[model samples]
Target: MGRWEPNARGRLEQAALELYAERGYEQTPVAEITRRAGLTERTFFRHFADKREVLFAGSGRLAELCAGAVAAAPAAATPMDAAVAALYAAAGVFEERGDLVRLRQSVIDANAELQERELTKLATLSGALAEALRDRGTDDLTARLTAEAAVAVLKVAFEHWIHGSGEQTLRHLLGECVDSLGTAVARGPGAAGSVSG
Candidate 1:
């Protein structure tokens, strides 16, 4: 029989992040996390597969959010438009969790393995998004490139948002990043302006 724990998962996550920031991820153990959370190892395993998953719990949710947003975007929307919609969806999911997400990023930034895991998760999201775009009648190659571009845009927007001051939304940051990227590409040599021939 399993013992019921009230808010055990949340407790575990909070404790794990606190310990990770204080002692570093590699130096922390499941036993210590459970102890800090005042829960048992069984309770910890009940909520998470391992310690690493605690920080990445949002990945699955964010992937689902992005794919669903892309699928639900207007049929007449361009690939970039659909991608922007998906980014807005991600912003909605992340907006309320800024502090926790920042801490998770901090922990990941300080660790190579966690950084790899973060990249792997983003790759997974890109593949899922490409599949979603294909379902919206896009060609495979175009869908793939579009999804990859979306990931890049999202990454840049997130970096800017995390490090910036003020009340800027991730959605706004995404739009600005996309606009900047478009401007840079548009102004490249031989792109409608710089024919010094």
Candidate 2:
């Protein structure tokens, strides 16, 4: 390989994803990933901590995007509204990647360890969102609740978007999930009380 090559990080990520899909995440080695990318293992380590990091390298940036969006929301916006804004911001990133996001999800779904890591990443994102809400003057309980609910909406919407036909965008699914959440909340305890045990 040339001493200087552009988009090394992108090449590494693409190579890793392809290898993981072809040979399974657990079975794919770092050496193989580097070889596939036409880069040295030193180059791979420069961009990522390990093979798994190839799949998750964007998590930190994603969290920052979400939290920043929540913090930048208008002062008049409700906590949930701010959280939804974060979700929309995240959707933009996923929408841009399109098939790459779907392929990454498939790779993660095929590995139990990757799935656990994905959950951990989502939990961290929820915490960052809660902190942003608190910075907006929301009370702790309200901030935590709103952030958790927003994350749940994101998770559900992402699953729907990944599995559904290509017609519906993630932003649309997120809006629908938000509406469903509102309907469920609007039903209130009385709605549940009406049902016989």
Candidate 3:
């Protein structure tokens, strides 16, 4: 994929996404994407480093947005609360394009490499959240664990949002997930005073 072209970035990304969604990530090739977009091989390379990069281009930026949101939250907000707020803020950036999220998820689910990349992206976002928390004077261990738990809740909430009824918006589902997590944590290892005896 090396035929230099101009202004093909968006087209290339759109084409890659379409092909990935249509034929699965493993089966779709750079050439196929460029062909569908009516562009040359060089055009694709000029726009994206590779086919997989297209799926993850915005991941870093999204992580930054999430961390920023967390850092900006009021001091009164608990760490979990701040993380959830950050996730909700990021959802506002994402809620505009339900189709894109679904398509990307489909591709990632169908391909191990894409799934790995997604996991890595999630880890990166979690780390960013932890760092942002530290900036807010949260302890390191608390920040790390809280960030990880928040992302887990976000993942569950996102799935519920995507596959379940659309009536429960992401924010609402996130709140439910947070509450569920809190309840679970409150129960602790013994659960319902089992260890008291």
Candidate 4:
């Protein structure tokens, strides 16, 4: 089972997730997780800074992938396009494990603390994406708002993928959200002025 325990990090994450789901995140002890995983407490601590970090396994790496994708996008692409592309690229890492994804999501949904941590991770990812946009010459405000909007779309698309009607793929859902955002952006000042009139 050495190959199965190849990395203490993943073991800790899996153990924590299982325990969290069974006993609630707030109630699950770090000791119990390490014990259940057949690992030492020191091994768990070496991988995760704390119990909370165990719940957010892979978030940092996924954010880096997302930011890299945005930074590499063509300048001609709209901010929404860039954001959606990043999310799409990130989706590749997730699409292979639908069952694990659903289980992890369920655990997060079952706890308010986990939900807050998930939101914070998304916000951090958005900031990274905004910085990538700014590096590509977008103005700060525009980059920040565009990043926010893109993340919102990604969030909706993810939810839809997990819980919505299964007719649309996540990539297609992201593309559709981008198109809708593009329409709103195109309407711009004219749409706003007409509304006020």
Candidate 5:
């Protein structure tokens, strides 16, 4: 691809991913990424703050999508239901970019810095979901807890999707995780017929 190509941002992202996978995230530099993409350093800077940003660029969009879904959910939906619905909304994006998502995960898995960045992004998403839930009239504590739990569900489902066999979609895994959470919550600490305050 030429530097003047239409998808300069995409070209930069693809190039960064390829380099990150092959050379490792910390080992790869912005210059090499721009060169691989046939783009100038100026162009790379135009689209991303740095090499690491390439891997995390979509986080903003993902947060927006999840928060929007939460905000748009039916008024009668419970906080958990609305939050999980956001996960379902995000599933479509993950499903559409399965290969790239897996590759990106692999890159992050290999680098401690990237892993921390990933966690930070997830926390931001959780905050966004919590704010959306509050906007829906959920109380502060309930909204925060529900959002945190929903983000946990997302993390678990994503791990399973990336590591498990290709039989189940991300959406299916998310549902399974949500069901498991519900079961555990329902059983409580006294499921064996014992009660403790």
Candidate 6:
């Protein structure tokens, strides 16, 4: 096992998020986040690059988890299966923090800069997944397309997860989103007309 401080990083992130909501992301300094977390500013720098990094810390970890999942997927798995596996990897990284995600989402919702950073993070995750799939012998086109679809599913599933009961798992929500996507694709665009009948 490695060094762990009872989730000091988690505490700092949660504190920063709460402060972002109350004080605005720009207004909240690193010192304030550390103070709120009952930690020192030195500890904050140990876990993150800067104040802006608090909202983005998960992106790197999630990308690593996704890439590892894609790399470990069975040789017989299809591109979509590999992509789904990458999405499944998110459960371990995010499932326990539905409330924290909800809070972070609210802050991002109110801040344009954070919204752009979120988009960049999603793109980075997609790129990482695509690269991992390519390493697994997937064609470039299939790998990129599957990775994008999977990342989109992750975003939508995470949106759903943050809105529902905290007890619900991220993996379960991801499965739901995947099923919904499949159903919509099977029904085609014409299915929308049926809603009025």
Question: Which candidate should be chosen as best, given TM-score against the real structure?
Answer: 2
lDDT for each residue of candidate 5 in 1-197, tens digit (9 for 90 to 100): 33466899988888889889999988888999989988888988888998888888899999999999999999999999999999999999999988889889999999998899899999999999999999999999999999999999999999999999979999999999999998877865547656543
lDDT of 4 by residue, 23-115 (tens): 888898889999999998878877888998776868888889998999888889977678778989877776766666776888889888778
**For candidate 2, lDDT tens digit of each residue in 1-197?**
43667999999999999999989999999999989999999888888999888888799899999999998999999999999999999999999999789889999999998999999999999999999999999999999999999999999999999998878999999999999999988866678766966
Q: What tens-digit string does per-residue lDDT give for candidate 6 at 73-145?
A: 9999998898898898787667567667778899998999889999999999999999999999889998898
Name the better of 1 and 6 by lDDT: 1
Give a tens-digit lDDT track for model 3, residues 1-197: 45445658877877888889888888888889989889988777766788888989888888999999998899999888899889898788678767788777888888887788899999999999999999999999999999999889989999888888788778888889989999888866758688667
Local distance difference test values of all predictions, in order: 0.88, 0.93, 0.86, 0.83, 0.92, 0.86
- Tell me which residue pairs clash in candidate 6: none
The residue pairs in collision within model 5 are none
- Worst lDDT run of 10 residues, candidate 4, spans 1-10
Task: Give the CA lDDT, 0 to 100, for residue 144 in model 3.
Answer: 99
- Candidate 5 deviant stretches above 4 angstroms: 1-4, 187-196
| Total residue pair clashes for candidate 5 | 0
RMSD of 4: 2.9
State which candidate, 1 or 5, has the greater lDDT.
5
Best by lDDT: 2
Winner on TM-score between 4 and 6 is 4
* RMSD each, Å: 2.8, 2.5, 3.2, 2.9, 2.3, 5.2
Better of 2 and 6 by lDDT: 2
Q: Cα lDDT for residue 164, model 2?
A: 88
How are the candidates ranked when ordered by lDDT, highest leading? 2, 5, 1, 6, 3, 4
Per-model clash counts, in order, read: 0, 0, 2, 0, 0, 0
How well does candidate 3 match the true structure, expressed as C-alpha RMSD?
3.2
